[model samples]
Target: MTATATEPSRGLAARDDRVATRPLAARLLSRPEVGSLIAAIVIFLLFMAAAEPFRNVANVGTILYGASTIGIMAVPVALLMIGGEFDLSAGVAVTTSGLSASLLAWNFGLNVWVGILLALAVSVAIGAFNGWLLLKTGLPSFLVTLGTFFILQGVNLGVTRLLTGNVASADISDMDGFASAQNIFGSEVTLGPVTLKITVLYWVLLTVIAAYVLLRTRVGNWVFAVGGDAAAARAVGVPVRATKIGLFMAVGFCAWLSGMHLLFQFNTVQSGEGVGKEFIFIIAAVIGGCLLTGGYGSVVGASLGALIFGMTQLGINYAGWNPDWFRTFLGVMLLLATLVNMYVKRRADLR
Candidate 1:
């Protein structure tokens, strides 16, 4: 009995950790989004107390609409950052996508769908190109994407001028397939008392897909591996190149979708638009639990981050505060969030 009891106890102690359940606190701390979630709740409560308009059910759609726009881009930006890369060009890339599609559809008199399809191809290719270049040259992604950002920015301006003789692309509202495209990308959906832009639905769907991929799929493992340590992952047979490149393409694809929303909604393209927007996307991802160091993040957290932004941005206005202080407020939130995330990460690591 003594021998048998000791053997079983030893076996239990040596149980494979892969199948072992972590303590609840450890598990909770391990989630990147928990800190952000708490922050979001705090902010929401503060706004609900300070601003009567914020408490109105009618404003729910407006808040979600704002969140969805940033959330859409935040999802992919979170993924790319997870893969240890940055796309500074992401902002201008959205403008490029809209401008390209609008210019082609109008100038050629082709169906709007044709330009959209072609733009998809171009956008994906641009992402692939960024990946390929990074792999070949071994330069930092920030540098590579920064160059692309400037190039695309200039092209957006120069080409729009060249084609339309104006700073913006011609309105494609009357083009063939315009209505259909608008219905798909720009329409609003009514949900009982709240009506929301289609992007809200898209944002939620994208987050679900990204979380599923990051958690359930082989691709997700590859992403974590590459981000954590590329050289080590490569030695272990991870497709680092493909994974990183694919991540860039994902960002490109999201940028395309966001651009389509802008295009279909407004029926016009502003060449100078979207500049400085990449930082917002990055900040959202960072707030969501993605570290600047790469390899650790949560898509759910990122979406929540976008929600925080939406609430803060609109809540200030609803509260009758000076909107000019928005930047300062954003800075405060970012700093607080970073500190909270860092403390959470350290606690998780200790556990």
Candidate 2:
């Protein structure tokens, strides 16, 4: 063969070889997310088999109701984690935001919409303060957020006790726009034999939007950059500080949403509400594919993680098992997921 002809033939063979190897490489590098998803499905099926009551439509609705709050909170928490920071106060923030809105509307007779705005504003302030503290002190996020968590926890309890003299929640039914808010947050619309709560449907919608924002947008790229290496990101003009601060605000805002829904749904609150939820939110994010070290995660994966929790919570009860085991189950799941995440991260780092 002529040299030129031989070169072209060799090039084609090399191209074919590259194509064949690409998919294999991708499969190997793929994290445990796919496996986790499959495991989630298996868990679901197991619940279905052993828990006959779980198969009922009403029970399904209950799970959805439970999952909604957790899933909603998980979205922004996952985003924040992917951006490389954690918000330890996010759990208590829920109570703060909820109480803010409820008290404003019920005590001062502020319009529901106005009260909501104020509550969100409070959340933003707290979130921004968290970011500012982290940036200024060069402290680890864990310590920063732990401080915020304690402060907020105190504020939630102290303020509520001083004002209401009871752990029961403030009611805003008399506030304007209360009906509309209820329709959005509290109303349930049925589909055939399946009853659906608006919160669950809202969760599904938010998950879709959050997933798109993370996986298919420039902001998503920024999230990874900021989380992976803030110094490098800032050096490259990626607005690392702004991104991290903004993510904290987003987490706060989500807490507000969850709190608002809770206020409307239950029409009551306890000072202790949401005190232990921060870890749960993080767990859901990690289980979904978020890395503790940041720069890697999927929103859909986080949502799935919430579903797993929701399933386990209800499924166990339906299965007639001791509810006390949930704590143990959560501990096991967290350990397993963390180990898997660490393994995947180590392999990627080596490459």
Candidate 3:
């Protein structure tokens, strides 16, 4: 009887040991986002300590507002990166979507809502075309997206000049449905002493949804498999083409949403706007732990990366530094984060 009782106790202790160690082991294996999270915290504290205005409630809202716009796109871009692809056109696509809406409504006398819907369709179709061409041509995504980026950029400029006789879209603030759209995309909410833009809510919603899809779904598993090894994933019956196409479309969808916010908030969009923002999106993703080689990253990490960007951008201004140095700071952060991510990934691989 004593021997049997001890046997059960031993088994129970073993089970408990596994239960305790499982999460730690999993965390060790999933260390890509760890570095970014730490970086974000460190940067936040650094800014707070050095810049008094950075700690103000209103300023906190400003930081988040800036973060939201970038974070909104970064989430989907991170997922696309995890799926082993790039969307270089993503930035200009925002302009395309906004221009589509603004020009469609202003020039054609269509309702603002109608223009918005048309823009959504056009953006999604553009993304689908990119994915389709990538698969059909067996071309590098960077090259394929670069082509689309230029095409869209040219269209944005050429068509805006042709239609508006100007480099910017006509103001749509007085159009039907403008007010409602603004309320959805550009409105602000006051919470106690802080006012927050609606974009923050959109950013949070997208992040949460993306995290769920990445962590808790079969499709998410397919994303990892495809990114890690597309051939192997295909051999195992993953829908590789469909997944890639879907990811591009996801980027397109995000671009459209962001464009809508831009249009509604300002009631106009520069035809040349969003030209270089794609690099920012990719940089944010890279800083968040998404590998250039694909197959490893985190949505939360990307969000944190965007948070770092917002804080740094505004923090510099609060510190009375030259705005031109922001790009220099981004380059430094990119290099440092890449090194840290590589080290973390190496350690994880060794284990």
Model number with the top TM-score: 1
Model 1, residue 85: C-alpha shift (Å)? 0.8
Model 1 per-residue lDDT tens digits across residues 1-351: 899889987897779676677898788877889988988999999999999999999899999999999999999999998889999999999999999899999999999999999889888888999999999999999999999999999999999999999999999898889999999999998878889999999999999999999999999999988988999999999999999999999999998999999999899989999999999999999889988888888899999999999999999999999999988877887787688777777876765
lDDT of 2 by residue, 1-351 (tens): 599899998888887744555555555556536535865898899999999998887677888777777999998999999998999999999988888888877778778878888998999999999999999999989999999999999888888888898775676676698888878768898877678788898789888988788779888889999999989988988988888898999888888888888878877667788888999999998887888889987788788888899999999999999999998988888888777777766665644
- For 1-351, candidate 3 gives per-residue lDDT tens digits of 999889998888887744556558566545788878888989889988988898888777889999999999999999999999999999999999999999999999988999999999999999999999999999999999999999999999999999989999999999998898889878999998788999999999999999999999999998888899999999999999999999999999999999999998899999999988998898899899899888988888899899989999999899787989999999998999888888888876754
Least accurate 10 contiguous residues by lDDT in model 2: 27-36
- For candidate 3, the 10 contiguous residues with the lowest summed lDDT are 17-26
Q: Rank the candidates by TM-score, best first.
A: 1, 3, 2
Model 1 residue runs over 4 Å out of place are 1-22
- lDDT values, one for every candidate: 0.92, 0.84, 0.91
Q: TM-score for candidate 1, please give it.
A: 0.94
* C-alpha TM-scores of all predictions: 0.94, 0.92, 0.93
Report model 3's TM-score to 2 decimal places: 0.93
Candidates ranked, most accurate by lDDT first? 1, 3, 2
Query: Which has the better lDDT: candidate 2, or candidate 3?
Result: 3
